[model samples]
Target: MRVQFSIALAHLLRRRRSTLVSLLGISLGVAFFLAVSALMRGSERDFLKRLVDNSPHITVLDQYRSARVQPAELRWPDAAVAISNVKPPVETRGIRSHRSKLESIEGWPGLRVAPVLRGSAVLTFAGQQQGVSLSGIVPARMKDVSTIDEQMVAGTLDDLAAAPNGLVIGQGLAEKFQLGLDSTVSMVTASGGARVMKVVGIFRTGNAAYDEGETFTLLKRAQVILARPNRVNRFIIQLADPQQARTVAAGIEQAIGYKSVSWIEASEDLLSLLLVRNIIMYSVVTAILVVAAFGIYNTISTIVVDKRRDIAILKAMGFSATDIRHIFLYQGAVIGLLGSCAGLMLGYGMMHVLASVELKPPGVSDVVHLPVWWGAEQYLLAIAFAMAACLCAAYLPANKAGKLQPVDTLRGAI
Candidate 1:
């Protein structure tokens, strides 16, 4: 077997140019496959981490509200006219009874719920007006549902108590307003009333939507401004395992006898967007692999034709047809192994290049760098797939060589 392998190696080496071309094709395909899979996996992981870190795995809200947009304060001012345009309601209920249920929810296995009051308002600093989303939370309770404690860039929510009419703003918002922790900003409610708030803290979420629009204050204060006393917009639920978000969401809904949803379910459109991107990438990679497989088939067919005389001589010497087939099959396997190794290195190199560059989505300035995941499964899958393609490519030519009549092969014209 060793001798046969040695001969097969020499045969492949003899046609170095063709071997190199075929190997390059295979390597390119495998590299693309590896890189894309790594990118997708990394993006998914990063997105999930951000979701769980800044927000919650599950967010329980009233059945009447759509999860995509912020809660409304009231029925549209012109219900019939607004229904014609399908605008989100201006007013959303924030009943305190919903928050009162958190105690029972916290007792459930693998579940933690935090009450939050979120509403829209306008803030004026230095005569400049900016719209903001006001979010109210108990400092300790907020920590139970998110990484708010870690995201504080300056000051503390604890100071909110000392400074009545105090609020913690996002870094992005502060920068936009040119305000600081001690700055006083007057917020105008949707109802045209105004309240002055002392900026007690600033935070950065690295997400524009949140960091640009969110302002945190005591629930009692926010409720007074929004004119919804003792009511909350939503209950953020944290789970032990985010993977179990859907299951726990169902349990929470069952317990509350109301509609509820996980972050994944709430953000179906976002998930769908990711899914579409991945599908497109996978399709492109698959096409490249198919072309590489065809190249392998052509290379093996050429090899068969080139070695016709040798095959005839071996057969004449009583080498079985099965032995002839194994010789070529083994050659294909070696080609696959070498090409796959080269491909892995190529893929890793490309990932390194991507890591150095800053990439951001449109309408956002934050750079979301790509992440690399070097998984055992990715390596093993590349090798197995490449080998399988090569073996399949070799079969037709190898079988044809094995079936040739020795005399016919030997007497063949040039």
Candidate 2:
């Protein structure tokens, strides 16, 4: 092994220019792989964080998964009765026995639940009217599951609790209405229920749609205005582990009979797009390394051709074909190992530069930087792929050199 390694080292030292060029190619490839992968993965995780923070992990709506079946069908088992043209009765659009439902949800491990009575209403102030999605919530319970508390720009949910008729609105909505804290506005529900409410809190969520259209008030006030007493239309839930949302949502739906939607289910199309984006990213970056591997192939192929006599003499001098193969393989291993180390250092430097950059996004008051996830898997992935590509490139030349016959070479030379 020592002799094989020395021979391999000698081959590289003899062609320092080609060896250096191959090393540079691999190092650049690896550095780009690590840097680009870290940036892309960071952005993906940041997007998911926004999705989880701004919205509930799971939502249990008042609606059922399927339409209610007729009692006559249940009573007649094998009668083969087909009922036609039956109109379903109009029922109240709110979850029944919501207190018990809330209790049941909170009883489950690692889940936090909040009851919300959401309805459409118009905010009329000074003869200008704008439509908004109004939500009634219990301040204490809501804080546990929703981000409104974190997004508040003016007052807290406790202010709404203090004033039963207090309203919490989005910054865009308040600006449109020219309203502020303690400003009076008349809220008219679709059910013809109307109330004079005061703006007690203002929030900005950075989502244009929500910022311009959503409003929140106390649960009791919402019930009174929406004409649904002791009832809620949705249960907004958060989990200790957001990844467990789908399973938890399924269990909640099965237990309560209402339609429960997980964040993953709600964003199926977006998630599919993310998966495709990752595939494209990895494919494009891997191509860079694949191109770099060609440099290794060229260097090794040149070495094999130039050192034909050397390989033949080594084979004649008690060195086996496997030993000859190992000599060239070791050359690739050396290049790959050293190149990967250099690439990792360069990649880390790139990440630091990216992390230092700050940008002011539109509609956001605070300055933010690019999200960069520093995880170990990407480093391992870069090294593994780099080594694999290098080894594969080395194999062809190594195999060719090993199969050469000393007698044929010496005979051709004469």
Candidate 3:
């Protein structure tokens, strides 16, 4: 068996170019597939981590039917009444709150609740007007939800100067208005066109959507401008442990007597996008691998016919058909093994090259770094698939050699 294997190996080496090409095709496909899969997973994980780290774990909103509300019109539920409503709430609804009820959630177990006043409005300065969504936050409360104050690119939210009338703008918004720190702009309320605000500081949130359209003002000032005087939209909450988010969220809903939602629950659209991307990616890679497998089949089939005469000679020398088949299969295995190894190395090298290149959209951050995930599992999977394809590729050719008639083969008849 060992001698037969050596003879088979010699044949493959003599036709090294064809074997190499076949191996190269399969190896390249595996490498590309692995690289793409790693990149997609890495990007998703990074984005999720950043989002969770920088944003509140939970948020409490009034679950209102309309945009604005007045405390006089709505009675604030007390703590006892709020807690008694303990139960799971519906999705897509914000948690309900009044100033007293919202403020009451501050000391809840494993939770930090912060009242927020939010609304959409238009900013007008130097005859340049842009529409933006304004969030009224207590700087102290902002700390509980995010470390965004530290991410400020050009100005500080301190321009609110601890004053009720102070305001901050996102970096993208700042560029649009050509505004800087201490640069003031008038914010016109979209609600009944009732108010205006002065932009005191500009802040960059590092999120394109938020940075371009988001602005912040002190909670008290926001109330005054929007004419709500003493009410807020919702209480943004941060949990002590992220793993307990659902539990904490349920508690908030019951404690606040209103519907509540966690980030994972609210981010269904983003989740859908990720799922679609994964499906598309896997489907494309699978197709490429299938095509590469066919190449293996073609190469193996051609080599089988070329070696039929040799097979007949071996059979006449007393080699069994099974032994003949094993020789050709071994040749295919060698090709598969070498091809897969080379592909993995080259693929990883390409990924390293990609890592050094900075990628970003125009007028966006200077660089967007992507992460790469490589492991033994990926390599194993690639090699396993390649070998399986190679084995299948060799079967037909080997069978043909095994069934060859020695008499006709020796007479130079195919």
Candidate 4:
């Protein structure tokens, strides 16, 4: 094996140009694979972070996911009685007995819950009217679960608690209505009730739709203006570890009989899209390494054709077929090992360069740098795949070399 490896090294060194070209190809492939994977995976993580930070981990709505089964259906076991057009009774459109339900939820450890009465209302300022989503929140509880506190540009959520008639609005809405803190605005609800409220706080979330269409006030005030006293339609919850939201939401839904939605469930489509994107990315990048492998194949195949006499001579001199094959396979392994090392260093440099780039996109207030993920698994994966490709490429040539006949080679040379 040592003799075979020495011969393999000598062959590669003799065909220096071809070997270097193959090595360069493999290195470039691995480098690009790492750099691109870092960017894509990093962007995914950044997007998810923003989503998790901005919204509740779990939202408990004032509705049931499925219709209630009638008592007749429960009593009969596989009875073929069919009921048609069974219209359910009209009831109040809010979470029933919310206080007791909220208390039950509060008993759970590592959860922060804030009750919200979300509704729609028209805002009138200086004869300009705009419809916006009105959310009634307990300021103190809301601060614990939401990023609104951090996003506040002018005032704090505590302002809502201090002033019962205080309103917290987004920067987009304030700009549209030409209003500021301490400004008065009339808000009219669909229930034919109107109230003049004072602007106490302003927030900017950088999302145009949300910034322009959302406002918040005290829970009690929202209940009064929306004509639903002592009622809350939603419970916004944040968990100690957001990843456990799915399990926690299921438990809450079963216990309270309300519709509970986790962020993971709500973003299922986006998550699926990201997964598909990663698959496509990996396939395309892996193809680059595969193409580089073809270079290795061509180089080894050429060597086998040129050195048939040498292979036959070795076989005649008692070199086993397996030993001859190892000589060629060793060449591929060496190339793969060296190329992968060089590629990893090059890829890290590329990622560093990318991370330094800064740009200010449209509508954004500050410059943003590219996101780059540095995970050890990505490096290991690139090296492993490149080596596998190199080995597979060398196999055919190695086998051909091992099968050379001394008599046939001598006759052909003559």
Candidate 5:
């Protein structure tokens, strides 16, 4: 085995140019794979972080997911008769008896729940009017469940509590209205009820739509403006472990009989899209390594052809066909091992360089660096994939060399 390995090493060193080319190909492929994977996975994680941070882990809405069964349908069991155009009974749009429902979920461990009343209102200022989403919240509870406190650029949620008529608006809205702190904005609800609220806070969330169209006020204030006093339509929930949101949301829905949606459920489509994106990205990057394998195959194949007489002489001197096969396989393994190591180093350097690069995105106030995830698993994956490709590439030539008859090869050489 040692003699076989030594011969393989000598052969590779003899064809240094071809060997170097193959090594370079494999190394470059592995390097690019690592760099791309780190960046992509890092970006994915960063995006999810922002998404989870900005939105509720779970939201309990005032509506039911399914329509209520009619008394007629309930009374007549197994009736095939179809009920058509059954208008559900008219009731108030907001959640009924929300206080009791909120009380029922109180004291649940690792949960922060805040009641909110969301409605659309038109903000009129300086003769300019824009429609905006208004959310009514308890400043104290909201601070526990929301990232708005961290995202606040000026003033605070507590300020809304201090002043009943205070409003929190996003920077985009503030800029659009050309208003600042203490600026008064006229808000008219869907019912034509109007209220004058002073802007006490401005927040920037880096999302244009939210920044431009979302506003917040005290829960009581929102009820008065929307003309549904003492009613709350939504409960925003944050969990200590966001991954447990689905289970908690289901439990909450069962407990309170309202529609509870987890962030995972709400963003299912986006998650699926990301999964598909990752699959495509890995497939494309893996193809580079697969292509690089061809270089190894060609180099090994050429060596096998060029070293036929040497192989024949070795076999004539009592070397087995298995020994010849091992020689070629060893060459492939060496190339794989060395190339993977060099590639990893290069990839790490690339990741650092990428992490250092900063770009100012449009409409963003601060420069952001590239996200690079440094997971050991990705390194293992790259090496495993590259080595597999190398081994597979080596197999064909090894098998062919192993099949060579010493007598036939010597006759050809002579």
Candidate 6:
């Protein structure tokens, strides 16, 4: 093995230029692979962070996956009654016995729960009318499952809890309606309920649509204004570990007989798009390594042709076919190991350059730097892939060199 290594080292050094070119090709290919992967994965993590922070991990709505069965259908499991003239019963909206359900859900571990009565209403300030979504929230529970408390501009959720008739509106709505803290505004609901409520808090989310059309109030106040007594229409849930959302949502839906949607379910389209993007990204980057492998193949093949006389002499000196193959394989391994180390250093430098670049997103005011994931797996992946490609590239040439005939070569020389 020492003799083979010494021979391999001598062969590589004899054709230093070709070996240098092969090393450069592999190193550059690996460097770019690392840079692109870091940026793509980093951006994905950033987007997910914002989504998990802003949206509920799971939402339990006052609805079922399918239609509800009649009481008679429940009573008679196998009875087939052909009656077509009966009119369907008109059911009231909102979840019944919401308090008991809330208590039951609160017993679950690793989750935060809050009940909300959401409705649509008309807002009139100084005789100008605008429509908005009104949400009734329990201040204590709302803070646990929502980041709205962090977006407050003038007042807090506690202010709404303190003042029963107080309403929290968006900053854009406040500006458009010329309303501010302590200003009186009239809220009108389709259920023939109307009240003049005070604007106790204002929030700015940087999203024009959300800021201009959403308002919040106390849970009891919403129940009265929406004309639904002792009921809630939605449960906002945030999990301690967001990865368990799908499982938790499924179990909750099965237990409660309501439609529970997890964040993964809600963002299926976006997630699919991200998946497609990753596939395309990997394909493009791996092509670089594949092209670099061709250089390795060419260098080894050229070395075999140039070293034929040396090979014959070694074969006459009692070197086996497998020993000859190992020599060439070791040459490829040396290039791969050296290239991987150089490539990693270059990739780290490139990542630092990318991370230093700052950009301001369209909706927000603050500037954030480019995201660059520094996961160790990417480094391992680059080296493993590069080494594998190089070895595969070297295999054919190594096998051919191993089968050389010393007698034929010596006869040709005579």
Give the lDDT of residue 116 in candidate 6: 96
Q: List candidate 1 segments past 4 Å from native.
A: 1-7, 64-92, 190-194, 313-321, 358-368, 410-414
lDDT of 1 by residue, 254-373 (tens): 777556778778778988988898789777776777688777778878988888999889889888898888888877888788888899999888877766768888986667678766
Relative to the true structure, candidate 5 reaches a TM of 0.93
Candidate 5 lDDT over residue span 52-144, tens digit each: 999999999999989888888889967889787898777657878888888887767889889999999999999999999999999999999
Candidate 2 lDDT, 281-337, residue by residue in tens: 999889999999999999999999988888888888888889989999999999999
- State TM-scores per candidate: 0.81, 0.97, 0.70, 0.93, 0.93, 0.92
Please write out the lDDT profile of model 3 over residues 1-414, one tens digit for every residue.
798779878887777787777877888887887787778777877777776787678776666323333343357634244333334444322233375676577667777777788888888888998888888788876866777778777656666755455668887888888887666677778455444455566666677778888888887777766666667777778777876777888877777656677777777688789899988987786676667777767776777778778778888999888888888888778777887788788878877876676789788746876776666666677677777777787777878778888879999876
Error of 6 at 30 (Å): 1.5
Winning model by lDDT? 4
TM match of model 4 to true structure: 0.93
Q: Rate the local accuracy (lDDT) of all candidates.
A: 0.79, 0.92, 0.74, 0.94, 0.93, 0.92
Writing each residue's lDDT as its tens digit, candidate 4 over 32-87 gives 99999999999999999999999999999988999878777788857898665788
- What is the total number of backbone clashes in candidate 5? 0
- The clash count of every prediction, one per candidate, is 8, 0, 2, 0, 0, 0
* Pairs in clash, predicted candidate 4: none
For model 6, the run of ten residues with the poorest summed lDDT: 82-91
Local lDDT at 217 for model 2: 96
Q: Given candidate 4, what's the lDDT at residue 209?
A: 94
Ranking of models by TM-score:
2, 4, 5, 6, 1, 3
Q: Pick out the ten consecutive residues of candidate 5 with the lowest summed lDDT.
A: 87-96
lDDT of 3: 0.74
Best by TM-score: 2
Cα RMSD (angstroms) for every candidate in the order listed = 6.5, 1.5, 7.8, 2.1, 2.2, 2.4
